[model samples]
Target: MRAPLKLYLAGPDVFLPNAAAQAEAKCRLCAEFGMTGIAPFNPDLDMARPAAQLWQEIYADDLRMMRESDAILANLTPFRGASADAGTLVELGWFLGQGKPVFGYSNSAVSFAARSRAQPDDALPGTAIEDFGLADNLMIEGSLTLPLTLPPDGQCRPFDSLEIFQLCLEGIAGWGQGFNR
Candidate 1:
């Protein structure tokens, strides 16, 4: 039998208090969808090191995992700021650079412009908010093969919502890519 597709699961969930739990849940979902989910973090990394060293090790490990994956499934929900997590974007870019298919989902139903405050008197003045009426930056939006979004009336979803993530899986399955279970 053929091997299942390996997807680099990119998102801001790694910084959450329940990072491991979220990863496990995502992996389980991926299995149900007949794919292998490769989350960015490696719990086996040695944490007993200097801050810089540990960070460097993490970066290297994440790159290695990304290289081993077939494609990326990114969570493009708004993070600490008004945009998706910067690190997740980097991972997506890495895959894109390699000409790998990229998929993503946003728990929010709101458009990027609607969520952004770009009026002249806006508290976050000066820089112009990307008002393209997209779920995220135009570049990211255009990169996705399937950018699943929540229902139009969906409320503010937490960073870890899996509703749209599952939608992404379904989209992949329906793509007729001949994945192996």
Candidate 2:
């Protein structure tokens, strides 16, 4: 039997309880589609450390998963409209850097550019306005697009989570096939 496609799922953890729940749900769904899901939100992982250290650990953990996994599924939803969780972003980048396929969903009303616009212009001299607008992965804007199919780098999709999952599953299946070739 073929090994199940291992998916390294990435997302924000500021909403620890909720984020963790969502991660598990996604994992189960991936399994339904014949994929194994791995997430950083697992209880065994040490995520309560200092920011710097936490990031280092997260990078290491995600890198290992991406190296072994078939693809990635990321929740691009902005936590409190700030942006997709920072650590999740890092994980996404790591997977993309490895040329792994990525699929992400954003249920956020505010775009990354909008968040920067919301900040007071004088808030910081060198503040880099981070835009959660686009990433290397597939942006699932399922509900946000409604009957219309928006381009990959378009607006946010309020109801596109399911579509995102389907797309990611397909992408992962295809990616995994490449590995067997």
Candidate 3:
């Protein structure tokens, strides 16, 4: 049997519980496809550490996993805006900077300002799609591709939402195999 492909999942650990479920489903899908999957699971206790130390640990672990993986799957769901989790965005940049293939998923069918409860003091007052683009930066340079894995409108289903997960997995597997050549 062919070896499993290694996937690196990126998302917000602070606010997105759905990210964890997505990661798990992706891992399971990878296994089904005979590919290895790697995802970071930051528990509440991990968040209890000092901010600086916690960041240090998180970055280190994420970096290690990215370095060891073949590709990345990122959740571009906005935490505070129409883009993605800040940490998730940062890691997406890193992965792209490394020239790795990137796949992004998001429910950004709406504008950023529309999603915000209140404008930040530093808010630029612009659209989220314009700020973040339709896809992650790296994916544009032939390194990534943004595919819609969720409905454009309405609430997104949970990670245990098997149908969506399977769809995502199938896409990833196809992508991985395409790049494997």
Each candidate structure's TM-score, on Cα atoms with residue i matched to residue i, is 0.89, 0.61, 0.68
lDDT of 1 by residue, 57-131 (tens): 999999999999988999888887667889999998998899888998888777777767623445645776788
lDDT per residue, candidate 2, 1-181, as tens digits? 7888787776664246476666777778888877898866645567688988877785676677778776667766665545556666666666767776666655544555766677567757776655545332223332111221222455556532555555556555655665651
User: For model 3, what is the C-alpha lDDT against the true structure?
Assistant: 0.61
Query: lDDT at 147 for candidate 2?
Result: 20
Candidate 3 pairs with clashing backbones: 4-34, 4-35, 4-36, 5-35, 139-144
**Per-candidate RMSD, Å:** 2.7, 6.5, 4.6
Tell me the spans in candidate 2 whose CA falls farther than 4 Å from its real position. Answer: 18-20, 45-59, 80-82, 124-181
Per-residue lDDT, model 1, residue 8, is 94
Query: lDDT for each of the candidates?
Result: 0.83, 0.60, 0.61
Residue pairs in clash, model 1:
none
Q: Compared to the true structure, candidate 1 yields what TM-score?
A: 0.89
Candidate 3 regions exceeding 4 Å error are: 13-25, 42-49, 111-122, 125-143, 146-148, 152-165
